[model samples]
Target chain A: MAVRADDIPVPRGRPRLAGRVREWLDQESILGPVFVTPALLLLVLLVAYPFLMALYFAMSNAFIGRPSEFIGIRNFVRLWDSDAFRQTFQNAFVFTGIAVAFKLVFGICLALLLNEQLWFKRFIRGAVLLPWVIPTALSTLGWWWMFNSLYSVVNWTGIAVGFMDPPGPNWLGQKYYAMTAVVTVNVWRGLPFFAITILAGLVAIPRELYEAAEADGAGPVARFWLITLPLLKPVLAIVVLFSTIFTFSDFNIVYVLTRGGPINSTHLFATLSRVVGIDTGRIGEGAAISLYLFPLLVFVVWAQLRFVRKQAY
Target chain B: MEPIRRRRFLTTAAGGLAGILATRVPPARGQQREVSYLCWNNFAPASDKKLAEIGQRFTRDTGIKLKIDHVSHMGPQQAKYASEVQTQAGHDLVEMRMHFPWLYEPQLVDVSDVVGELEKKYGKAISSAYEGAHVNGVWRAVPQYHGMFVATYREDLFKKASLKVPDTWEDLYTVGKELKKMGNPVGIPISQNYDSISTAGPVLWSFGGMEVDKDGKTVRINSPATAQTIEWYKKMFRDCMEPEVLSWSDASNNESIQQGKAGWIHNPVSAYIVAKQRKLVTADGINHHRSLGGPQGRHETDTPRHIGIWKFSKNVEPAKEWIRYLLGKREVYDEYIMSGDAFNLPVYDKLQDHPVLRTDPKYAALRGEGVQYHTYGWPAPPSDKVQLITNTYLLPNMLAKAVTGTSTKDAIAWAEIEMRKILAG
Candidate 1:
């Protein structure tokens, strides 16, 4: 089977010329490069250049419709001085930490539970992704309307049931809980992707291995611990890394929810970067806030490389 | 794995294909002096009808065309302007106001002569509309309408609650407190913007607290008077508004009031039109008048909705001609006045006694009411600082902190620190 798969043709490595035409063989390798050129160019143009430019922007006193000045590290220093920036950074961490943690644990548990001989299994699996399927902006808008105190479902339930007569609390307005409200919306949107990814990994696992573990007098938990989790580690690492990178760079959820309001309760890196850079026209400061995500991406990339290598250890 | 990969490929292709099909194909250009107007939905149905007639007339007289691209809000409109200016995009006429001119500085041209003619035709009261449209003695825009920084309340509820429209700073606070206890959203805003900040500031000013003074120089928010004002506003938020207020936009705030959810709100004359469009209130409930007197005196700022012909226009000649038709003639001004009272003033001084404004022969009353020193006093901040001051250091946020038990001193101090920082930059 291995030889047959190999014999099908590993075309990427094929030399195209004989001894008289070695240079032509080098030119024939052009087909390999040609096929992926557009993607390579796009990845650099769209992703890499913009990332580098953002770092450059962070070091300058840049603003729109105005002349830029080279104010190296001042914007970063200013961010440290600002209470708003400090609060925004803290909120971003808290939101990403809580939401990602919930998505991981619950995602794995749900995936394992659903990987069974259940009726309507496909339908249930598809239906679980309803939250993820909806356009994020539209869904976040729905969440915003639902949190409305005058006609909000949350407020309605709180006020009518005598949860507290005078004030059921201004969930969005109160600084202590505004962050929690934003995190809840973020977590709800994220859970489905994590569940689906882990479920795919679970289904790909060999049943014989699990049965062999069962023959060793292992319970379901033991088998999961010994077999399923060990096999699922690579995908789980990828899933957590993807969720962390994306969540750390989250702008839309917090922007739509609070616009960093109720006294800077929910300002995150992405939204604050926009407010400082675009809306406030402090492009330098905005770029500084945005560049914080780079270190995070670096960690993810390192983990990704490590995850791809298979080892007995 | 093969089936899944094929499915993914097909799914991505389908999404992209659908997007291409859904876009609107642009119409082919014809030879004509065409101009594009970029602004918000200042002219709703009434405003739209007047504009269509005026546009057709302009096409007839000068053989030029008018392309209308009115948007729904000011924030996005300003953003679009910045983008258009940067790329030198295709807007010929743009409606901008207040501090927006400073952001562009000398990028726009002056039309002081045309503005002067309209001011003469509409009367001296009209000159007040140009208060913030001119930059350093050069005019860049002409006033289309006036939107004063005022609060709107359910007049019927006010009478029912025995609230005689609160005469002083104390009256507003006491009455607002009373109204809250009896189940009324004194005010709630679900979104943030300059409109919210501008209206909310007057409430603070009534207690002898001004965020930025008449000259647009000092940030006097750290004063004892300012602290007291903020503390009182904090009380208003805690005692009165819905929590959803902080979450609402200007339109949503209007929705709250129109839906009978909120009793009072600091808003513009546009609210009357908004209510009319939503059919929230009948004809009888659309009351127009001045805001309450401050502890010092009854006063407010001149909030005019203005329009401009961009200096960077693809066809500046046609745009300038269009601006003239929109506001040049007396009859055109009348059409604007009738269009949901767009201009916010009556055509004839004698005829200002409509049920929409003053009752009886109180023609001179509006002049005295509107022409107060403080109302025309404060110098408008530039557009860039306007965004920072309004969005970052708004009264609603101040009220939120105070209500949430953020120390009054700390909130005020921090706000001052931030406001001064932006101003200095």
Candidate 2:
């Protein structure tokens, strides 16, 4: 008996092969994974591979062009004994903490101001983003020149304003000043990311809530504390979490401006890792130095995510 | 229809696979030869242009292609060299300076044949060249030229201060103190800069301090001599240097002198050359002198340049030929030197009197200055450990710590510990 065209199983031909794939991909379970495969593969290749390699290198006595042998935790033990490494750890925390705190406060203030009615609002918003948009290395070079001991523009300006004496404060000469200078640059570069992201979240908040709060006789500060902040918690949490990680691993601002100079006062994890791994050819130790912050960052991210989820409930 | 579709699918899949496989196969080549070089940007732009022109000439003379890649002479270039060594595939010839030849010796091709040929034509290579390029009875690299730290000073300021050109480290301290009082401070970088190491080398050696013994087996950094050197540095830093020296970069000293803020700076002639070229400082205002003598004797640090062919290079023969062509001919070498405004010095004794060195009165003192030049490791053969110490700026860090308030004993002790760890590794 002859079958109709639709009665057969499409003959299992090449065209049917494509149809079967489409049918499989259309299923919810398969579709989710199929859609995510590209990103998953990318993460595996770019992130997971390098991370595993770093882990391997950290546990071994590795150098370029040389065979490596497993040395276990000796690198970490040696680093723990090093004063320089200890200083680096302290610096990473101080740099990231101070920078992120200031960035949050300033970002919120800037975002609030931008949210208000003002002349040239578009122009101001765009101009405020210039520091963030410019390449970090290039901008750090500019900062380096401005902080030059002899040709420091900051000193010249200070002198011109009659606020500073002949030799203005050596912005990066002293350890404290170097830390402050690096932190200042980090805040300057990072503030815009916080502001822009917060601004986006602010815009996303419903207008009805503020009106309702105003109807209940809530003042501006109270409304912000009660409504705006509660609503912005998720965005702020994510922003701070990411900024903390980025700032902790910061290298360019420190490397270009001071190169962990003035006795390594401003060395972040990345710069110290570079000094050990690439410069000194102690790949194992360098890898260990870089991984020092990974655990802390993971804990921070995990805590932030859990906090955000609880807030949602 | 089903059979036809199946056939098409199989054919397409096979074709795709074949195409991918074909891409993996390298194309056949004839006798054509090509080589690439990675080098730092020259002190003089014209020198780079001249090098490029010479590359073109080589391509014309011999039916081979030459490509030159220039990178900034800073951390990135070092990273690039490390990456290249790790991969074992990159530019055929790499321009190495200071401790790199020793650092990458295992991966470098022995260029003894080229060195021998050049030595036959010219006289023996300079001591700095031998110290830097030759290691373990093998000429791992061909020494090109070395940049020495000469005392580039403002003549008018010295005369006004009644301070004769400093001949000794003591003179520098006294003169620098006087000059500092006169508002023109001496700019000896005390930071983690290459110049800091260069400046410290003379002081450390002149005080008879050594980082490692000549055998490259023992650490000799912590000693009475080292403490003495640190004491001198502390005094100089307190009296002559502004606190800003603690944060200065490699280019800071040059800028300080060119901007007329410094009375004296121990740097290569590039600063003076740039000042004259840019009319930032007059020719009469600037002069060059020998680096100050220490208690033992006058010694200067040499930033020696070397040309090394990678062992993995496919065109090692062509790369060596190009290096020989550049260094072997006196006229070619002289032209290159002139292009650099006498910035590049001759490594061979025969080329020492090249007219480029004598034509300029300011550069007169720089002639044969390589005689007193010493590499970073000084007494020790520059081993991998020595290179690590130099690259990590251990000496500068120790001096910086001492000058910035860490006690001399503590600084030296710390450095000795660091040195021991590196040597042990």
Highest lDDT: give the candidate number: 2
Q: Total clashing residue pairs per candidate?
A: 8, 0
Q: What is the lDDT of residue A88 in candidate 1?
A: 81
**lDDT on C-alpha atoms for all candidate structures:** 0.68, 0.86
True contacts kept of 2: 0.58
> Which pairs clash in model 1?
B99-B383, B188-B245, B189-B245, B189-B248, B190-B247, B190-B248, B191-B248, B191-B249
**Measured by TM-score, how close is model 1 to the native structure?**
0.83
Best by DockQ: 2
Error of 2 at B356 (Å): 1.8
Model 2 C-alpha lDDT per residue in residues A1-313, reported as the tens digit of each score: 9889888665558888899999998899999998899999999999999999999999998876678899998888888766678889999989998999999999999998999998999999999999999999999999988888877899999999999998898888788989999999999999999999999999999999999999999999999999989999999999999999999989999999998988778888899899878876778888999998787788999999999898878
TM-score of each: 0.83, 0.93
Model 2 ranges off by over 4 Å:
A1-14, B1-29, B368-371
